[model samples]
Target: MATVVFVHAHPDDEASQTSGSMARAASEGHRVVLVVATNGDHGDVPDDLADGETVVHRRRAEAAASNAVIGTHHVAWLDYADSGMTGWAQNDHELSFTRADTEEAAQKLAAILREEGADVVVGYDWHGGYGHPDHVKVHAVTKRAAEIAGTRRYLESSMNRSAMIRSHQAAVAAGLDVGDWDPSAPMDDGNPLGSPEEELHWACDVSEFLEVKRSALKAHASQSDARGMLEMPEEWFAQGFSWEHYIEPGRPDGMVTGWFLGEETVG
Candidate 1:
């Protein structure tokens, strides 16, 4: 079985983005490793977590639990500080992931890839999946490391514009709010088309994995509130969600799409 390593910008990003594929991969016996780029130290904290260090420690524990739920064997971090989104001003911090030397970060990730002998390395798209500076840096570093290690690389992303539009329409039909999701934003750095077509390499049917994903997201109580009851019922959540999308490396002609079969079948 191939060893697949997923590089992410924060603690819960794995759950938020790729938990289904991770679960399916591990269940199918592929060794899965989660490489979180940051400690999520800047995440929100509850009133009970008054101690600063304690909050960090708690978030780490939550991340660990989430990893376990997703069937990941290893969860390592680059141990960098979070670089809040661009234009936040705090991004100017000396130690933020955004400010970290790209070469240095790439070297560090390359070392991990070498030690793990990872066959497949997954990371966010160029837009960092949503323009988060840390996410973008993680993508850059993962890309560099994959190049250095000579391992196949993939970028995790949502559905293409048509699919996303359909999903949003479905959500709206189900009484879910679409006001917050902006479909017009540019998905990546180079693409000006805004909502350009996405090449999905693997579409993992993670409807069953949604619970695991939700639990994982719930684990990060600091950054977000997990108590929204949307129009889509829990049952719909299980059945409606069909795929975890991806963008493969070295394919510039267009978006290459497929599904993860827990093997090197090249779906």
Candidate 2:
């Protein structure tokens, strides 16, 4: 069985971006490891909390629930504080993941890759799908980690920009209230979201895993603030999230249309 390690920026990111690929890998008996870069300390605040409970506690529990649902075999954390958004005050925080030394963070992840003998290390795309500060840091750190660990394949979890545009249009036609966010427009970092479809190397179909994906996202209950994705009805959710996209480091074209791994069914 191959070992695939997915390195993500925050607690809920794995659930949204690469959860399907990770779950599919694990279901195929490939060792799947998730390395979360931060505690998500600055994420959406959940209203209902025990007297002293913090978002950290809530998020950790949520992440654990997601880990179980995704069938991930191992989980690790860099324990850095979340770097909020592009220009938030937290961007300059000393403990923020964005402020972390790229090499130093890469060393930590590289150790895990070496320990797990990861055959594939998955990172984020160049602009991190919306250009969040910590996500960009994840891209940087994961790239260096793959190099340091000498991992053979480095697949970047990416969005198919063209596909997303079509999907958004479809959602609108279906009368789904997807909000005013125009994904095609420039993001906080002044770069457009995701890569053009032609630039994507794979579109891993996780439709069958839709239920699992929804369950995993639900695990991050504290993220109720972002209700658009979380509150979507069943059919709408399926329509919007049936496929998870990716890019192979050197390869620039072709779509997988199925699992990231080969179609050999597992027992």
Candidate 3:
């Protein structure tokens, strides 16, 4: 079985991006490891803080629950502070993931990759799907780490623009309330949310693992209200998330029908 590792920027990013594949990997008996880059300390601060509990502590707890739901065999962290969205003062913090030296952070992630003997490493897109500061850092670090560790495969997780357009049309036809965020809008850092569908190289049908993905999403209760992912209805969730998209840095080829590693995992 493949030792697949997914590197994400924050706690709930795994839920929003690659939880389905993580669930399916573990279920298929492949070793699955998740490396979250930050403590998510800058995430939504709820009104009710239990005495001295900090946002970092709360997010770590949520990440643990998410890990269980997604069937991740192991999880590690880069131990960096969360960098808030673009233009936020948190980006200037010395401890923020975005401010860390790329090679330095990559060395840390490469050590994890070497330790796990990772066959494949999943990371964020070039613009991190929406150009979030931490997510962008994750992309750079994961790429460098994969190279440093000589990982067999490196995939940048992304959204399919055409698929999203279809999803929006489907929601309209199905009479479901569409999400609040506009997928087409230029995000932070002034880049489009995801790569064009034509530039994508791989697509995975995670429908079988949708239930686990949903559980994983629910596990991030702190962001449930702040984020729009879990707000959608069951059917819409399936339609919107059933297919996960990816890009290959080495190859700009069009997408092929396959899972993260290959077709063998399906059987």
List where candidate 3 sits over 4 angstroms from the true fold.
169-180, 225-227, 263-267
Candidate 1 Cα misplacement greater than 4 A, ranges:
50-52, 153-159, 169-177, 185-198, 225-232, 235-241, 251-258, 261-267
Model 3 scores a TM of: 0.92
Cα lDDT of candidate 2 equals 0.86
Q: Give lDDT tens digits, candidate 3, residues 91-189.
A: 999999999999999999999999999999999899999899999999999999999999988989999887787766777788877657566778898
Number of backbone clashes in candidate 2: 0
Worst 10 residues of 1 by lDDT: 187-196
| RMSD value for candidate 3 | 2.4
* Predictions in order: lDDT: 0.72, 0.86, 0.87
> Across residues 21-73, which tens digit of lDDT does each residue of candidate 1 receive?
88878887888999988877777775677545565687788888888888899
Q: Which sections of candidate 2 miss by over 4 Å?
A: 170-178, 225-227, 263-267
As for lDDT, the candidate ahead, 1 or 2, is: 2
Q: lDDT value for candidate 1?
A: 0.72
Q: How far is candidate 1 from the true structure (C-alpha RMSD, Å)?
A: 3.4
Residue 218 in candidate 1 has what lDDT?
A: 70
